[model samples]
Target: MEGFVQNTILITGGAGFIGSNLCEYFLGLGNKVVCLDNFSTGHQHNLDGFIENPNFKLIEGDIRNIDDCNLAVKGVDYVLHQAALGSVPRSINDPVTTNDVNVSGFLNMLVASRDEKVKRFVYAASSSTYGDSIGLPKVEDVIGKPLSPYAITKYVNELYAEIFSRTYGLETIGLRYFNVFGRRQDPKGAYAAVIPKFVMQLMKYESPVVNGDGNYSRDFTYIENVIQMNELAMKSQNEGAVNTIYNTAFGERNTLNDLIAYLKKYLSEFDSKIADVEIVYGENRIGDIPHSLASIDKAKNILGYNPKYSLQDGLKEAVSWYWDNLKEK
Candidate 1:
């Protein structure tokens, strides 16, 4: 069965890495797409290929502006809310800005979508929502106190989304994404993810820094899997689907040390000079979970969510992409 869907989909932050990819997938299926982005954290070049597409409409706007959101959602059928200020370090450094973009911006989008009578409001939640919970496989009902301002914002999103659905009758779905990585994911900047950072470092034949002892484990998800969850969440018709959240991950875990080894091994084939590069370690940053493993049974049984790529498989694809695009540039 087709997922809870409509003819035209409104995707906020449509120029970012995940948003752009979602735009491509939905537009490919002959759906009219309205992409709203302010280009604060997202790049304009990310949506270059789709700007001319007849099914795609680009609105240069910010989610912080309720007027912009209302205008963008006027005739939207489904809403995919992917815009947010990401990174715990960034949030720790500038909590107020993060709260404004992630919390205030999220609430504004929800209100706009509800006012526009959108069919489904799907949002990008974070695994950081799990926060200080020490559970091996995190469940939706179970959560710990948010450790970072960023985590608090995401958890607050879920809370607000739940209330909106109950009071305002807005149907909402949240995808709590794990460590997502893949093509078009930005590798530049201080708060870049470990994979992309390592890939860039390996390209320069430089040692990549490992945070803490490198034993910290994470359920590193691929961008494709994340897109799948978003698609499934938006289209799900089951009554149990709405006003809920799901873990979008591979149901597998990997450590930083292992990830580094994999990157070095795969990247070394392209340039033998990277083979001998050593790794440096530093203290673990605050707001990071010690270990993360997702029980995908909820997503698997409910949404038919099937992640086709393993950690190694996803990394290989990401490594190749970085080698071709990032290295050349």
Candidate 2:
């Protein structure tokens, strides 16, 4: 991160959990950041802390629109493309909207970046790309058939990125994110991620439901580690690093039961009654892989990426943030 030059960066979905964090981080790094979001899944309140900054600009637009993509990428040096309809169940329910945003929107951004001659295009890929592969620790080279529409869309993004890199000479890096969770992640929706959603339920002394017997595991990554990978992908000068995919993860897996235990432990600190909250188990949802763990060796060796947060470390921070910022509401 040292000796990195400041440049104007465009973050699609800049008002969502991860995108908003990127916006705040890059703005703090003395770079001009233009945020483009349609506010469908992204919340406007996520931009509150830094919205007034002169270095930050907000474009109320959607990535599905080519003109909006073009207008946002104009004069931008880097594109952190994170806009997409994310959720296995939601994607199952509405594949069309998911494809329109994840696939078509991604293509629009790539075209805009190529046309604008942006320096690099870093995107938010998903571990769902690993799909039905039963491999314990997933490596970049291998993958299985996608299990859901959401997985299909993310894999398509990677393919499109590689094609754009080869066919258009654009610099691209795809970060295959695992089950990412942290502050500002929405905890209210039916499609809300498990971590934040469970946290909210426990805070209210309600039973947090587990989809299965709670043995399904994931490489739960932290937001800060994700930020690190994005920055490294943008600034990496290594010849072999660009135009490749890297697993942006903590390289460790935890089961849902383990996650619940930690969540209860952390939340109990704020309210002792949270310790008594029960967890309910239901039928396993469709299109869910039994386990997911990342092999980050490629990212570390190629991009010099080192994730600074473990799950417990990040959960502590996330729980604290929710307690202070959201528990009252």
lDDT of each candidate versus the true structure:
0.90, 0.95
Estimate the TM-score for candidate 2: 0.99
- Using lDDT, give the best candidate's number: 2
Q: TM-score of model 1 relative to the true fold?
A: 0.97
Residue 41 lDDT (model 1): 77
Residues 1-329, candidate 2, lDDT per residue (tens digit)?
A: 56444689999999999999999999998899999999999999999999999989999999999999999998999999999999999999999999999999999999999999999999999999998899879999899999999999999999999999999999999999999999999998889999989988898899999999999999999999999999999999987999999999999999999999999999988899999988899999999999999999999998988898999999999999988877866
* TM-score of each predicted structure versus truth: 0.97, 0.99
lDDT of 1 by residue, 66-86 (tens): 999999998888999999999
Instruction: Give candidate 2's whole-model lDDT.
Output: 0.95
Q: Residue 186 CA error for candidate 1 (Å)? A: 0.5
- lDDT value, residue 48 of candidate 2: 99
Q: What are the clashing pairs of model 2?
A: none
Q: Which segments of candidate 1 are over 4 A away from where they belong?
A: 1-6
